[model samples]
Target: MDNASSQINISFNFISDISNIDYKKKKDFSNVYNIQGMLNIRIENELFFSEEIALLEFYIQVKKWLSNKFDGSFYYNTIEVEGDDNPLIKFVASDNNYFISSPWGQDKVIAKAKAESLIESIKIFTEDFEEELYRTYKLNPKWYI
Candidate 1:
């Protein structure tokens, strides 16, 4: 689905920026995964960012776009971030000042679909997130590979 190489650069840029975002600190609470194919993407940046409300808006946008492209598939079914306690990305936002890393993601691929469908889903998903680069990656997602 992604014949052009334009998306690679965009996706990389978005992933690289996650560490810079300063997530809120709190215990595990309720952040609604109100959409289909909502997966966790863990990123670590050296520079800390401010204003999670902006970040939250970015996330919602990313999820919706990804869902449309992948026909409803989420990444990070099991993800590991770059700077998490482990290489595997795990993040849990409790409030506005603390984000915790936990190795609790599962390693499951959807069993109901054919391998062809999975491949198509991944391709579309990749492109979808890529579109968010420069435009709005925060509104984009870290939909795992």
Candidate 2:
């Protein structure tokens, strides 16, 4: 590992509650579902950057990677800006009830590597989200690897 390298660890969560269901005939209060996780990545032989700037770069690469991998428009929910440094990246998939984090590293290549790791992690699931994407979008399954 290079001394100049940097690492970013991002943890995120997505939650949905059925509180909108006003049940007139039942006593049940509400139903909820939460999907959350964490990711840690390190970029070697690259320059070190602040956590905030690195996160922004990671997210930009994520959007690019997804667009290249799958066709059609994929939009993120939040790109919050704070303290006038740079815009922060946050992705929320309300339709699929997904909460995901952008990858971070010293450079674009490092950030991309982290994003690829995330895709590989998805392939390990029994109900693989990446597989579903392949089927739905008619994409090559090997791309995730």
User: What is the lDDT of every predicted structure here?
Assistant: 0.30, 0.31
Best by lDDT: 2
Candidate 1 residue 3 C-alpha distance from true site, Å: 31
Writing each residue's lDDT as its tens digit, candidate 1 over 70-113 gives: 34323222122244323222122222212322343333211122
Tell me each candidate's TM-score: 0.26, 0.24
Which segments of model 1 are wrong by more than 4 Å? 1-112, 137-145
Angstrom error of the Cα, residue 91, model 2: value is 12
Model 1 lowest lDDT segment of ten:
3-12
Task: Evaluate model 1: give its TM-score.
Answer: 0.26
Candidate 2 lDDT, 61-103, residue by residue in tens: 4545464752322333223334432323333333222233333
The per-residue C-alpha lDDT of model 1 at residue 134 equals 22
Best by TM-score: 1
Rate residue 125 of model 2 by lDDT.
29
